[model samples]
Target: MANPTNFPDLQVPGGRMHDDQELCEHLLRSLDRPALLEILPSKIDLGGTGLFAKEVIPEGTEVFRSIPLLNCIGHEMSEFMCDYCHTSLTNGIDAAGHLRIAGDALPTISRCTQCGVCSYCSKDCQRKAWRKYHKLECPVLGQHPHASAEARALYRLIAMVKQDSLSEQEWRALAYLKAHEEQWSGHLEDLMYYQPQVDNPHRSTPLAFAVAARSAVRGAETLMQPGIDNLQLYGLYFRILTNDMDVAGPLHPNIGRTVDLVGSLMNHSCDPNTFAFFEGRQLRVRSLKPIQAGEEITVSYVDAREGFMMRHDVLWFKYFIDCKCNRCEEEELRISTLMSQESSSFEDFYQAEKELIDIRNEVSRDYKAFRSEDGINQVKTAISTVVSQIFRTQPWPDTLLPMCHMKQILAELSFKLNTNPNQIAIYTLQSCFGITQRSGPHWVYALHSLATHLTPMTAALNRLKNTPPLLLLLALIMRLLAPPAPPATPPDCPATPRQFWDFYNGLLYELVLQSRKTYGTDSACAVALVEKYARARARSSWLGPEERPLPGERGFAERFGEAQVAMLG
Candidate 1:
């Protein structure tokens, strides 16, 4: 049968699809409610689909939210994180596997009494999980407490499919997502070598598929779901490989994965206007910039802040699409032209870029390497290496996106280490400059980090007083960072008669407002920032009454630019 969505038939191995044709048809049907955004052929690619705004979407506006069709905590994190809300329960845990919050600081989390695994943040989450698939999964999970995360997640999907647990609208929404099965079609053989138990590993298979197959087979036996076949199981696996999103929030202690049928409708762009954040089980998509009517709503499939080559590599290998976003196209052209013009410049960039990539690859291969004390020193070394190579060219080209990406990583590492606050501010500011000179998601989050880092302004100000360059750069950026109009009433700080503290309070207030727009009000980051502003403002009030400004701070402005440049070095 012809595919209803009219994308190519799923590239199932041996061209065999056991009883999946109905699903192919089902995916094309409409959802129960009218979609918030229009689904249409993408202007970026022919025969591809994308989501578009139906009306003007102001920056910080929430475009849509959806509960995951399925969710699972990562295997590494399943022990400490709530299986339902994905909250961390580490602090509350005791030896007996019973955990409760004192003073109701947070909802209490408890391990499943029967399974002694899969903690839930509240009884409500437990009941929701039970009704969804936990009732079928709990007994199986009890017997095999060590099932891989993918197995646990896929088992739920298979059981739900067999029992018709999914709402029809959900099944329809999922059908709309097309899988890149061809990417996995070539990995079947390698799968069986690693995992012999899978009845029929495809002729081409990778170890990842083998691991997934091993989990699926074990789960099948444990669940005893009738009619669950190899092709059916593999079909679900490929969909997850293609469409699953990381369940992440600024407050999340560890990342997990989930499949949100409607959330999967948006396509990838290296310059996406919308970003997704998770609140408990709900996924919310919000605009990062003002999106006018008819504008296509896009989200980055990979980290958009990465250099072009890295972004391209991920897009091609994982999603099987070549990004043609304007930023990607321009960066690609600029790099090629720069190489043709100056071979030495290109060679220098290439060598430095390769080193950074190697460091990243090493960290990915062994995450522990980036977390150890030794890893901290290695990152310090990497930062020095990039900084040295960066100034080699006169006025480093902004197109060297990798340099910015390197700075971003260095900043994150610095923040994680929490050893040197000065370095964190410098690296983060440098990274933000490399991408865009404007306020954006990067700026919002970076400022949030700084504000959060420097809270209780008295001590922080005293600590950073010696670093005038840092303060000066922050003031300049935050001034430039202000939106055309304030999102809310400015906290009682006046523009004239401004003390540096006035600007500082303004910065904190603007950051709190912008963060709420960018990350939704319910976001943990936004909430904390708001409270921090209130306390900071109150403290400023107690300091003293404001006086009219005295002028005549000569030559400070001229020295500002020069000092900043020297400080950057």
Candidate 2:
């Protein structure tokens, strides 16, 4: 069957898929919705499919957005996050609507009466999900309480596919997905050689194929249903490992994973021009830097902070690609200072793991008693000490799991009603890794945190040339994180005068012009700094003209006045 949209299958000049001059026009036309940019499914010089830009796409502009073909929240997080939309249920609420207690059950939570297995924030979410796929999967969810995240995802997809239920493009997309089941058999054979029970046909493979045999069979039933056997479950699991992306939103925690056929068209690169994030269920991709009309659009799939050797190993293992991106070629990464020295003895690794778990549990208990801002430092100190205790054997990078928890706590502590922004910024900076400079989901989050803590009137603006990294960070904060709508700006917050606001605005515009040379005109970093709020009526300025990065640059005196501004217009 051909694509319903008649999106030409990837090919090159002379009807071949190599020696590509330009092949994105056809795929760009195949997009189902209006897009500021188009996708070109063409072959790379490296002998694989690649997505290219069909036009000049500017940075900060929305590239495209795609809804998930199939997605679900992990079973462990089902109670704490919405199963349908993936909204976090972490905000504390009471009958009076003030956050009087910590981690109390949300008022919106509505427990399902029939299955008693899932929770929802509203009946609308419950009804919509039931109509979509939950009716079939609900019957079996109870039987697989300990199922792997991959197993749950497969179950949802298998259950959703019905006769005449999906569109032609949807079916074609599903059919074309890569399933590394052949790779699975090789691993199984090696495991079976040492442990024969692993190959038992009657036994369901734990984690890999955690669903009950009868349950999966019933879910995938239909005369018109595409054939999927028990072993094929492994194929689904493998495809998910390579293709799925976590769904995240502005205010909610990441609650689910999604995949799309066109989304997979883009090839991997460490230094990519494009970056992606979630707007609810839709995956939105945007340019991180400007691209010429014929340029190829790329996005990073792995954590870009790790060493090149570590990155090479992970990419080869999961995505089956060896990155030859510029950063890889330069080999200029800041190696980890995060050392956790330890012996490799089995007993030592085991004991350290136990101590780490105990510490985490203790921290969780103490975290409950103290509300936001109360004893935040105490929690941070205790957590950091525990992280140290667990580090006698494992390298710090290997202990990323615990370190992740520490960073999260520090972030939470930073939001205390009257926490010191400078103090918070210092602590947060110490926890950063090498790749935290430009982008990463967590790094961006930190940037937003730092932005909120900054009082624009502070003396930092005068020293913009001192820390380019911090300047880039502040710009990101202003662009991505808006002033909390409706100004719950704390009572203890400093009165931000007009001249101070003008200084920040003018400084941002100055950064924008500088970024055109360093990053790109379309770079999101520069665009954020000078986009709007920085321009106001001119007034007398401090800091001489010599302080300007550019000779002809405008000053706070030239653009903005001593008038308080609510936001950039």
Candidate 3:
């Protein structure tokens, strides 16, 4: 018989934090974020801890915000992206509006001396990064540039804690967070595939590389630190596995990752009251619904749109727990309903969906026709037709909307075929009609689809310089179906990300007027449209208008800077 894996102790060095005082205040104080959230320990098996709402909070209200404890850009994409801000450093334009491609005079990214691959946006960014654990990590990365994401995340945490030399209180708080060392030990061989190079200066097992990185800072002190030593490093590895959050950017939603201290207390739920978004290093949590006092404040650990079985499999594999959330319990599990189900309005939607997928796959295989589209008639028409048919029936706030697949195909298709901007505008209007007709007054699927579609739809309409009845109606529908701003920060800022937030929010107020016009004042659809906005790294098809850039026209990175500068002025 195989022996059981030896797991570390669950209790902290001292369990003094069993009292509620050491929750979030000290951790958030540095970021100037208020200690609005609190943690309560649980006796439940899957529920080690849970965060509770302090007061009756309204929808879209900012609840709590905190900076991540450890963060790093993805190893592969570390170059051509700012390590600090995560802005794309791909292309640049001079003050004279002249284009500069790769290897320009003013190089956008500065390569790290120790690790040749590590790149930063500016000197300020590089300096800020040095103070925040990079000083310890430089040598380890230089030795082997291909360290796994998990190892790097752990290395970042170890470096930060050792440099700051964590207080006992901080260590206690960290220990209170969950780790799956026992469960992880089962996959130990799979985990060790990406160890530090054999002859590397930090010449130890992957776990001890963190300690060796700390060697240069202080000799005996590195060995003496009790909070994150070699044993703790093993346990800390699993802690990171359990609690790390995706570090998304303005352009690319997920470019990196970070570990949250206080946010770890917010447990997983299929139906959650709270949502979180990134603002630089800070993580802002907001209420997605009217959370009552003493109610559990939770965020979705996985995309809720995933089918019950798919969601179950994901949660079970990643989290090692079976979800019994209300949604999970309520859903009637069936294969067809999850994947190829038939709605009332369209029995053949799935067939069309299959065609789109096949075309997308074929296009993907083609090295020439990567389908990142701005305005293509064939691509837009096919997508609109297929999407309209899919939601023809049961469109009222349907979570089963094929959002991910639609977004993927719409962004990447071979537009080598004939494309008419006029046809795209027409197809857009057709889809909008289908959106309203199928979804009716209070259909969230239609709203999200239309709002996302508006980027491309509006792009086509703008090219025509004409607002027909259909185009005008599309505008009204957009006003009725836009994303909103967080209650606290009203999103008027120089950053393109925030500007996009404001642009979306400005359309939200008119929802009542348009809703009333379409569905009458008393109907659910006619009432005000209320939605929580988390400055989500969402890709709105309408946000970026695409056509082949003019010879002097800005590229993606240049255009982002252009848009932000335009907003600033």
Candidate achieving the largest TM-score: 1
Q: Pairs clashing in candidate 3?
A: 371-411, 371-412, 371-413, 454-542, 455-541, 455-542
The regions of model 2 sitting more than 4 angstroms off are 1-47, 75-77, 86-107, 114-118, 194-227, 251-253, 303-314, 328-333, 336-408, 411-425, 429-444, 451-554, 557-569
lDDT of 3 by residue, 1-569 (tens): 02112223446654433354544456545443332445566423344666666668776456776666666777656877666655454323322323343465754776787777578867988888788668876776676576656667666656666466345555567777777666556544443453453335222133333333233223312422424345455676667767776664311335566777777777787677765555445666656568887777787666554445555655665567678877677653332453344443222533554555555445444525543343344555665676666545443222343334344334323213224333333333333333322322223333433444444433444454332223222333322223231222222332333333333433332343443333333322223232212122123324454233421234534543443343432
Among all candidates shown, the one with the greatest lDDT: 1
- Model 2 Cα lDDT, one tens digit per residue, 146-252: 45455566666655653123454554444445544565556545553545443343222332232232244444343214354445545555666567755544323
TM-score, model 1 to reference: 0.69
Give the least accurate 10-residue stretch of model 2, judged by summed lDDT: 4-13
lDDT against the true structure, per candidate, is 0.60, 0.49, 0.49
C-alpha positional error of residue 558 in candidate 3 after TM-score superposition, expressed in Å = 40
TM-score of each: 0.69, 0.59, 0.58
Residue pairs of candidate 2 with colliding backbone atoms: 12-16, 12-17, 340-396, 342-393, 505-534, 533-568, 537-560
TM-score of 2: 0.59
The worst-scoring run of ten residues by lDDT in candidate 3 lies at 528-537
